[model samples]
Target chain A: MCGIVGLFLKKPELRPQLGAHLQTMLVGMTDRGPDSAGIAVYHRPVEANQCKLTTFHANPDYPWRKLGGQLAEALNAEVDVEIKANHAVITVGAAEGSARAWITRSHPEVRIMGYGQLMEVYKDMGLPADVARRYSLEGMEGSHAIGHTRMATESAVTTEHSHPFTAAPDMCLVHNGSLSNHNNLRKWLRRRGLEFETDNDSEVAARYFAYRLGEGATLAEALEAGLRDLDGFYTFTMGTRDGFAVLRDGIACKPAVLAETDDWVAMASEFRSLANLPGVEKANIWEPEPAVVYTWSLQEAA
Target chain B: MNTIDLSKTPVRELNQRLHDLTPDTNERLWRITNLKGEHALAVGLTVPIEVEIDGHVGYYCAGMNKEAKVVITGHCGVGVAENIMSGEVRVKGNASQAAAASGHGGLVVIEGDASARCGISMKGVDIVVGGSVGHMSAFMGQSGSLVVCGDAGQSLGDSIYEARLYVQGSVESLGSDCIEKEMTPHHLAKLERLLSRAGIEADPRRFRRYGSARRLYSFHVDQAEQY
Candidate 1:
């Protein structure tokens, strides 16, 4: 089992403070998932066709600096890249209509799980406190964010398997339980030409959502479709540039708690993670009903 | 007596400190003050230490307790004293579901009511509830003694195996394969000891015992739809 948390700040100025709050929340749930942690923050887009990418893998001998230079030269774009023990974050600025297309064409083997105009995904293999300091997460500035602390039961322990997996532009997802039908779904998706980088069930779910989104359904509609088709125990939350949503399987074998105030909306795998939130005593905490789809739109709320 | 106040200490730190103390060390008295739904209080202890939690706990309080006499002064949440190998856990207030589920050994005493499935899947652990127990209290219970001093809810014992159930009040119903057998003198004597151990001044002669009839384990076509 893993722990996932997502917060959609009503105020844009609180973006920088989000990393600190996310670190605190993730810290409280360390026991649920002590293997790895990751965070993805989404800020307002600066250019029409620029995308920030972060990739975390288990390889320690990756030639990051050389790869960054090569990628920059090949794309003919200004690229800023940072590589850590098992991960790398790359930001690229391309021509207005060709940035995403160019990145996709250049790195066809890399699974582009999440893509957005201003999204930055950082991940590492350790506790949240260590990952926060290692990634300098305290300085992150974004309108909203989502994170995952993974325990790695069914999947191998690697940064690539850690979540808030991005499936399409401006869309990301984090999950908290196992999917029983993962093998079947993986074969089905592969038959449809979807390539998977990791064997984690979370990747299958992320791609399923993306497949639906590609078919012109909204994120909320895709999630509702998932509740009907996806089998097994799960309580997942996904976020996009404009909105956030929560989903629970037919039987809630896992736990999830949601608490929202006038200022902030938070969801965690356990209530202990929400213990230190402001107005926790006053806020009403609720467990999402089984097979229910709950969504919140930051843009609509604003 | 060294008194440790848990008001300012974290639960992990407090449990660690308690575990470090020796068994023969002078009776350490701890007062868990200002507790509001904390979890895993006094868990996994081997020493004979006494801990009194001041208020309600969230879950798994005193879990896997062995050779430690821990007492909860207030209501306990799910899985309290679960999988206890030895020692005793006395609850002054109500207990949540699965109070002593899968306990291999030891004694669990609840002063107040116990919610649903109190001893579901119990194995060799003796549980005595002073108040009533809810439905499916001992579903799939394998071994040990479960004594209920008050009324038993629906399906008092379901699909049980060798676990002795003693209830003093009316039983709502018996589950599949469970039947009320004749209370022998040996059963009466065991019930007496369990009642005394739980510190209840009740008459053992007033309680009725229930156990597995062993008819469901082996199935026949005639009994196919009986369950």
Candidate 2:
């Protein structure tokens, strides 16, 4: 079991405030999952934004820093580059919107996990408040964001297993519950040459959604594809560069709640998490029907 | 008695207030009304506080209770008094299935009827239902006593261990490997003690006992065909 939350603000100026409210919502749902926590925020770029691509390797013998430096040198010929750990946050002059695609073509196995003005993904095994403070989550800002608090049952408890797992640029997902047909889906995806880092079923789901989106399908269309094809219990919220979308499994073995207003849309695993939101009204709160796809768009923001 | 009203207070705060109270410190009484099927009501209590809920609860009401006494003024949903380690839970109205299910130790007295699979997979808790129980009552019963003052439903005591079943009325049907047993003086004594604890004045002599025949414990090729 795990908890996922997301918020899409209609007004770009309210992005910082929405981030603060999402932090409170995540803290309220800390009990559902106490393992690890991560967040992804989508911010509109000004002119050119830096993108960080971090990859976790199983082999400790590999020279991670040297590899990052070499990638930076190659990317710097086209733009300015800075390296940190196993990551290289590149700020390109020409590749404004194409940073994600360029990185994908250059490094096939390595994913452009995050892309935006500010995208930080950190994992820690503890209470949500403790983990958030440790990761400095309060300083995060964006127009829309998605987060996950993991309770590791099916997979190993590690940073590699922590979510908001990004399969491509500007596409990240946080999921709850297990996929019953994960093994079958894994074999099919592997046959299509899709690489998987962890054995988690959530990764497979992310890949499935990414595959659909890559085929020129809209976010809603890709989510509908998941509802038709994916089996078993799951409730997920995917964060994109513009907005976020939420989906629930057919039987709804897990729980999820959605609350929306004129200015903001918020979601969590329980209503208690959204109880104290700044502008939340009691009547606007409702639970998502089982197997139904519900989406909130920041594009409608004033 | 000290009375606390739960009309406007949040359930979490109410539970916290209940948890902080002590038995000898004060005789605490609470009137929880307008409860719209909330989960974990009055859960994980150790003090000797008495709580009276005015309406139905969703799940795990009085769960993991110890020392405190709880009385539901109205009907209860699933897993009421579930996994009760000690103390007593008296339901004034009909209880849903799995009442006192998986309870390790304690006493549950249902003044009204209990639904299907009552005390299913009971560990050691004693349950006394004044009205008839539904089908599969005490299915996979491990140990403890389930005394149904009314009729027992079908498949009663299926796959049962050492737990005993005493019913005053007729049994709809027996589960596999279960058969009626003689209610001797020893059984009468046990029933009397349990009935007295539940504050029921019914005579133990009129009731009959049912238990596992122990024929299904070992495998036999001849019995395999019968199954």
Q: Taking the tens digit of each residue's C-alpha lDDT, what string does model 2 give over A1-302? A: 89888888876667677557778777876877788777776653535434444343334344545555555565563444444333344545444345555556766555454555445454556788876775455776777777888888877777678888877667889999889898999898899888887888898999999989888998899999999889988989998767688898765556666667777788777655665665563224445655667776655564
Q: Write the per-residue lDDT of candidate 1 for residues A107-183, one digit (tens) a residue.
A: 55444434557677777788877887887776667667788898888767767778877777777788988888989
lDDT for each candidate structure = 0.78, 0.75
- Please, what are the lDDT tens digits per residue for candidate 2 over residues B1-227? 54445557778987898888876856566777766445688999888777887665555789888887899866566678988888899887767667888777789998877766788888898999998787788888888899999998778998887789999999989998878999988999999999999997798998999987877744445666665
TM-scores for all candidates? Answer: 0.63, 0.57
lDDT, candidate 1, residue B121? 89
What DockQ was computed for model 1? 0.06
DockQ of each: 0.06, 0.04
Error of 2 at A118 (Å): 7.2
Question: Worst ten-residue run, lDDT, model 2 chain A?
Answer: A53-62
Model 1 chain A is weakest, by summed lDDT over 10 consecutive residues, at: A95-104
Worst 10 residues of 2 chain B by lDDT: B217-226
